[model samples]
Target chain A: MRLFLLAAAVFALPVTALAQEADAPLELPPVVMSTEHPGEVAVEPYDRSNAHAGATPFEGTAMLEAFHGVEGIGRVVDAMIDLSIEDPRIAGTFVSHDMVRLRRVLKEQFAYILGAPVDYSGRDMATSHRDIGLQAADMGALVENLQIAMDREGVDFRAQNRFLAKLAPMKDDVVTR
Target chain B: MRHCQSIGVVASLIVATLAGPASAQMFDWVPESRAGGKLLLTGGVSTIEGSGGGGLATWAVTSGYGAEDGIGGNVHATYVNLPDYELRSWGAAASFWDRVEVSVARQEFDTGATGALLGLGSGFTFTQDIVGVKVKVLGDAVYDQDSWLPQVAVGVQHKSNDQGAIIAAVGGRDDEGTEVYVAATKLFLAQSLLVSGAVRWTDANQTGLLGFGGDRNDDVEPQFEGSVGYLLNRNLVVGAEYRTKPDNLGFAGEDDWFDVYAAYALNRHLSVTAAWVDLGSIATFEDQRGLYLSLQVGF
Candidate 1:
């Protein structure tokens, strides 16, 4: 009897409504859970699809906000640097690295690329690593580490791609081998 | 005779390309082949009229294998069979500088038994030759998937029907006409979806088979076409298209066209498309519906 009731409820949903429900949260997380007033009963899991307009998380400003200001960008760069040093493919490049200086440059580069007002005054990509043998494998490692850091930071997938698109061109300057 | 010569040239080109050391088709498995910056499936299927589009509507994508800074070309053969009519077509298209496309197609429309009703012999057919050119004027459909701006193009198709005598006898005022169209197509990567819409200004009746205008209506009218496609996987795309057409002939009413289709890329060299199509009415025949199959091989 319980199974029958469950099946009945599932079948009762209009296909369009079910489609909207499935895709709505998959694109943008609207309401995981919400409660404002405790005095009266509150509607848990509110439907806010129409409540917001032109504020999709994919907008440039919204994407920039996901980094949680300069602090979060710093954390992302730190994670990437840490992961790069652990990966066997590019670990040797970081063996003699100055962690503090690299972190600051990465933060500035990311901040400028993500639409922050800050200017990146660090050395151009080639000038900074002129002697290092940056091979294709090293570039691959850098990309993988950056991806992992973005995932850890809870950055929206679209925002991660937007950031990576700007960095992809740097490969020409960095990867000589 | 001219049509036969054109067919021979296109057929020879297809064979020569297939047998050559170079593969003109975009083979995704060989990523190095696309050093010129083109990607797989960005070149859409050939429309029935021989432009880059879905089954029935023209899209904004450039045709053939050419990418950002090169030239690419391809040939296609399409067959459509309905309850009372059939259409066979062959064409070749080329994309240059990844911005402009030019194509030519020859269509043979078999009236079947309906020819007998029109006082023409059974199995009588009408033929037309079409020349088309499109110029990409805006955004990139593939790389700009993260944004809402779609790729846009504007084009024109000039069609000339061969059976001028029969066409005039059936109330058609002219044997030739041109279609001017503007189309936009976009790809949304996250949802694996592609949607396109186009508006066209045309005066042709039965896609110019029975010819343009008539004693009934002599002016060009605007029509619309749209498509929605979903990628089931990298190798296949399933979609549906609808195109509105004008009814300028007083002899019989015309209905809009629609199709649901699946297109599969076997490799860059070849792809096959099959669709269930509804063309509404042809001549005086009612409720025309059938299967559409097309085979395209390219480099």
Candidate 2:
């Protein structure tokens, strides 16, 4: 009987320890624990959670301010339009019709630049110029005029070039003469 | 024994040294011109090189936008400087799925008849309307994970001279023609460069808009265009391109031209570009040099 009790004690001790272990919180892989879902098995909170929750103050507001800084783009757009009209190089190229188009185009351009909701409904550029004889020299003048306008607006040279690069493919259609 | 140990150590050291850098360099051949779901604004001045007998040099500005999912559109305006005349043009384009693009444009080439050649005096305008379509047959220049060849595309431009009566009087045949072209473009990310090359075949006469007045056989000639650029950063690129135009004139040959250009990206929403060009000559005229600049803004 004493021997049985000794064996029973050993077995009971092991079972009790196992039950305690089963109730204990689990230690998961770092990635798995880091991505803990609400429905996942409960786990002991790691120290990292304290650091994660202690995010910088006003982070959302800071981001909003940074975005608002781009609002200056409106001034740049206005400057561009003014420069187009004031600069003789580009001004000479514009017809009365082009001026009307310019106003609408600049307005839409600024709205989009400022991340405002807008849709462009301007006439097709090619169709508009069908009657006007365009020469390569004219294209050169227009390009120079644009550069001057950009320069006045404080647009960096590299930023200006990025904008120009997107327009290169239209040479085939635009240079009809 | 010491020598063997030294060799083993050296081998391990070498392996360690190469492993990290090799893994880093594994992404070299991937194409960088991916569809970023934002508008792409590109423009430049290009001269017709020496391919089309002799032609005039010109400057042009163009703008384009890419929709969120590979759908996009573009527009362009250009001016050409001739010795005795000036020309102007504008165009627009739409791209679908980044695999196909269609465009329609108009051009007006004015020849001031100062010299007493034809009874018509100065202000003789040659106008043309063009419809174009391009389809990518193979390769994606912007999204190849690993490849050396650039993105290849085939396209066609159909031109119709709006001044049919004027063209007919000048001995033109219907004032319409078709031009077919194939182009390839690639961006070298490590070098911050983009390169494009193209060959075009056309049935248009030298009097591009005027058509052929004589019984000249339609010439199917190959034209070439190429661009080389240095990327300043992710948003800005400055480049140069050389384009060869087809000589459509049966008489009074034309000379080709080339352009040097610079471009800038303002943000995800806007960009601009400028270029200086040398348009060789049209027929006997010379000294056709000019500049081009444009601005583009999109969502």
Compare the candidates by DockQ and give the number of the best one.
1
What fraction of the true interface contacts does model 1 reproduce?
Answer: 0.00
Model 1 residue A16 lDDT score:
48
Angstrom error at residue B125, model 1: 0.9
Q: Per-residue alpha-carbon lDDT of model 2 for B21-54, expressed as tens digits?
A: 3422432343222122322333222122101001
* Residue B76 of model 1, lDDT score: 82
CA displacement after TM-score superposition, residue B118 of candidate 2 (Å): 6.5
Q: In lDDT terms, how accurate is model 2?
A: 0.47
Task: Score residue A149 of candidate 2 by CA lDDT.
Answer: 58
Instruction: State the local distance difference test value for candidate 1.
Output: 0.73
Candidate 1 chain B: worst-modelled 10 consecutive residues by lDDT? B28-37
